[model samples]
Target: MSVERDILAKNDREANANRREFSRLGIFALNLVSSPGSGKTTLLVETIGRLGGELPITVIEGDQQTSNDAERIRATGAKAVQVNTGKGCHLDAHMVGHALERLAPAADSVVMIENVGNLVCPSAFDLGEAHKVVVLSVTEGEDKPLKYPDMFAAADLMILNKCDLLPHLAFDAALVEANARRVNPAIEILRLSATTGEGMDAWLAWIRGGAVEARRRRAAAAPRAQGCACAEAAAKA
Candidate 1:
């Protein structure tokens, strides 16, 4: 228990540093979490294709092996850094901070961190993202949220991907939403198919809204930051 607590404490400190750095740079970061085969990469590819022109976007791909996802992200001409976790099941805050240095995302831009495909470990590790967006495909059982309650409870929003497949599957979207709500009543839900482009506008709009707010926050903090710097300079004199 002590070891686990120590591990998380270190991660939290790193995460806070990352959050401050992101705010200072006016970067809106989103941590995308989900089980394997949740279509997270596909959604991200489509998202970048449509919204990258309007917003400066960079990607940090987290996986156990292979830079395949990062390659797909770069194919869209957006900057991407691949963090291969090797034996690790998740991307820790320290790893993401290093990746951010390499990504060098611009001010008022979005940094999409595609976490290693796992619901359990990623939920506990904070990557200093503005929000955690959990992706669940309709092909998965609705009881998923109930089984993986920690992930749903931790997420700010739950995205139901592969909605276009509803016609062919026995999956119950309503049940999944209900289960997710049971875990997190305040969690926002969005259903979309990355392949068919259905419901993407709403998702894109959400990203735009978040980016705007992130920019607003950075602008609001600038005066205080400058004042602190000036105070330090004066003290040195």
Candidate 2:
């Protein structure tokens, strides 16, 4: 237990440093967490397609073992890096930190990481992301938040994917949204079907929202940093 704690502590420190590095480079990172078959990849592809021309985007896909997701993203005409964590249940900040160095982003670029499909463990580690988007498919049942509270609780945004299949799957979109809000009052939820593109406008809008906000925040912050630097220089004089 002590050894495990030590490892986690080290990883946490590394994650914080990774956050600072990403911020300095002006990369808005987003970590996607979900269960297997929860449409993480599909959503990622759609996101890249939607935002491809709007902003420079790259992907880092985490899996226990598979180059499949990376290959899929590559097919979509976006740069992709695959992180295969053998036997690991989740991705930590350390893995993300190492991957970031390998795929350094230009200022104001986006790094979208699709975490290995599991709701629990990934929530424990922050990958220096602008936000953690949790994807829940209609096929996964409406009671998922009840089953996996931690992931739902940690997410900044909730994406209810596969809404095109809502009629077939009997997935209650209402209940899912309600329970998610119950668990995370602060979470913003969107319903979309990445497969048929139904309700995609909302998802695309949210992605654009982030990019726009990041650009705005960067624009807002630049003068403040510059002002501080000038003040410090004047003090030195």
Candidate 3:
């Protein structure tokens, strides 16, 4: 128990530092987490297609092996860095920080980190993101939220992906949402099908809103940053 706590404490410290750097660079980072077949990559591809040119967006793909996800992201004309975690089940703050260094995402841009597909380990690790967006497909059991309460609780937004499959599946969308709310009442949920482009407008709108807010924050901090630089120069002189 002590060892686990210590490891998490260290990870949190690094995550805080990463957050500071991200804020300084005006990057709106989001950690996307879910089970292996939750369609996270497809959602990202669609998202990039819709907002890539309008807003500078970059991606950091984490997987046990292969750069397939990163390749898909790149195909949409977005800069992406693939982090092969090997045997690791999650992407920690340190890994994301290094990926950020390599990607050097544009200022006031959105940095989406697609974490290794797992509903468990990723919940315990913070990747210095503005929010953790968890994707849950309708094909998965409706009781997943109850089973993986920690993941739902940690997520800021719950994306119900593959909604197009709802017609063929016996999954109960309402029950799933209720379960998710039971675990995380404050979590905002969005239903969308990346393949069919259904409910995509809302998702795109949310992304746009986040990006706008990030830019606003950066603009608000610019004057203070400039003043600090001027003061430092005067002191040196």
| Among all candidates shown, the one with the greatest TM-score | 3
Q: In model 1, where is the ten-residue run with the lowest total lDDT?
A: 1-10
* Regions of model 3 farther than 4 Å from truth: 1-6, 234-237
The superposed Cα distance between candidate 3 and the true structure at residue 52, in angstroms, equals 0.5
Better of 2 and 3 by TM-score: 3
User: Candidate 1: deviation at residue 151, Å?
Assistant: 0.5
Give the number of the best model, judged by lDDT. Answer: 1
Candidate 2, 162: how far from true, in Å?
0.8
For candidate 3, the C-alpha RMSD (Å) to the true structure equals: 2.1
For residues 158-178, what per-residue lDDT tens digits would candidate 3 score against the true structure?
Answer: 999999999999999999999
TM-score of 2: 0.89
Residue 85 error for model 1, in Å? 0.7
Query: 1-237 in candidate 2: lDDT tens per residue?
Result: 344456467777887897777676667788999999989998889878887887788999999997999999999998888999999988888888888877776778788999999988999887778889999988887889988999999999999888888778766789999899889989999888888888888877777777667767777878899999999999999
Model 3 CA lDDT for position 98: 92
